[model samples]
Target: MTTEHTGTPRPSDAELARIAAELRALGEPEFDAELEATPVASLVRELAVPTAFALAFGPTDSALPAGAADPAGAGGLLDVAPLTELDRARVWRKIVARRSGGAAQHHGPRAPSWRATWVAVATAAGLALVPVLSTPDRAATPAGRAAAEALGSQARAALEGVPGEQDGGRAAELAAQYSARLSSSGSEAPR
Candidate 1:
């Protein structure tokens, strides 16, 4: 089945593979099938997947060969300016900085409002009380103990009564009995 994209025609698998190999030699790897199926322009807008893959497979310094163009000239597939080692390094640094900055922003300290502090205290107290609340009632009444013992006995008896055979012998016997009953009732069971 063919995937449809607006703006440009999709490249054949062979062409994509060839371009992917060239990009790989340059340090970028081929896009996974999922990414390849995405419209080229949309892929470029996301930036991370294509940029990372290009950096992995495409040359760091020289302009990408003309053969490297995807049938759809979505900007992600081609770079007019060849990337140098320095350029690649810069890109790597920026990527790292963006990631770290995001993390730092997420983790940065903030003033705890009174409501937040109260919530935190309440959560802590609730967590601390869990063990006390969850502790089983060890001192059962004599009647309760007797009832529990009776229930346990019934469970054990039920388990013991169940057949544990894995072979179809029991099933076959049951089926035969069912068939016999059906025949006696003058009805044919479905095969």
Candidate 2:
């Protein structure tokens, strides 16, 4: 059975011309005499392809060859312009601009956020560890000495009655052994 026509309103002549212009802007590389005569040229206007979608497909032309069918007198409907190097460049520029709000052109490559974060973290870590990793023999300032004393006091408070209160002698023995090892290894741990 033949399918019934829905009689959907076709795109207006202006709309068709605009579509043709868009196709011309994005068509293939060249629209020579021989290429236009091919079925591909007619198919393009009939299809009303958008520039970005078919830009890679190469150029086409709407110029009907000798004895070609002239169903509609609208020249724009048959017109498929060829894409020149400059035209291709322009289309590409438009595409890129559309995608990135033209920022890619003004700004080159961007440093990744994670890389910047890592750099900041590394700098902070280096600064924080500098004092602890300084040469041990250097004389401490009053503030430095006070800070060191406070840290030592905190450590003593934490370990005040460590293994002594925990178990009879096992923890004390372990602590004693650990202390002896620390005293034996004279070089301070690296930062």
Candidate 3:
């Protein structure tokens, strides 16, 4: 039977359940053949790329801050004028004020809590770790090994990434060396 175009609306849950029951009534077909045609791996690959980008940079609508007047998201990103800069600074100042003990005054003082102390310590530790984890040195591949890799080595790059099983002490040493160099050079360090 030919089905008419019904304004392109999705089928209701009840309709979907009825259709599913009917499909089940017909003895099991080879799902393997249908799955091979539209493999789950290919489906995941199609969806995962978009999902990763979304998680990394957030949605297009979210690129703009809340209470922004623009509906079309027009003009260049930098064209938001002084509003963007001031808004960012305003948000950052509030974050600093709240984290510092200013929020306690607003909410009225209470006994010092260990949970807040633990959270503050954890946050500080995570922030300290960011710089160390951001830039990683690629393990020095042996000179002989470089030629093999350059000329199509059989070794595939692992999903877990380049396995640099270095001791944590080595990372600490690198950080110390970098800090010493900065102190000696008097670069004033980056903002």
Across 122-188, the per-residue lDDT of candidate 3 in tens digits comes to 9999999998899787666799568877655434545237654457977988877888888888876
Error of 3 at 160 (Å): 43
What TM-score would every model get versus the actual structure? 0.23, 0.18, 0.17
Tens-digit lDDT string for candidate 2 (1-191):
01111333323323333333343444423332322443233433344334443344443454233233335533443353434455445444543444353233224344355567889999999998998788487878999999999999999998985645457577888877777777779765422
Q: Give candidate 2's error at residue 114 in angstroms.
A: 20
Worst 10 residues of 2 by lDDT: 1-10
Give the poorly placed runs of model 3, Cα more than 4 Å off.
1-113, 143-191
lDDT of 1: 0.47
After superposing candidate 1 on the true structure, give the runs of residues whose Cα lies further than 4 Å from its correct spot: 1-112, 137-168
- Checking candidate 2 for backbone clashes, the offending pairs are 27-58, 27-59, 28-58, 28-59, 29-59, 62-78, 62-80
Q: Count of backbone clashes for each model?
A: 10, 7, 0
Candidate 1 lDDT tens digits, 1-191: 12224434444422333333333334322233332343332323222223544454454432234334334444444432233455445434543454454335444342335457889999999999999999998999999999999999999999889976535987888888888898788767546
Pairs that collide, model 1: 23-57, 26-57, 26-58, 26-59, 27-56, 27-57, 28-56, 28-57, 28-58, 60-83
Model 2 CA lDDT for position 93: 50
| Candidate 1 lDDT score at position 131 | 95
How far does residue 137 in candidate 3 sit from its true spot (Å)?
2.9
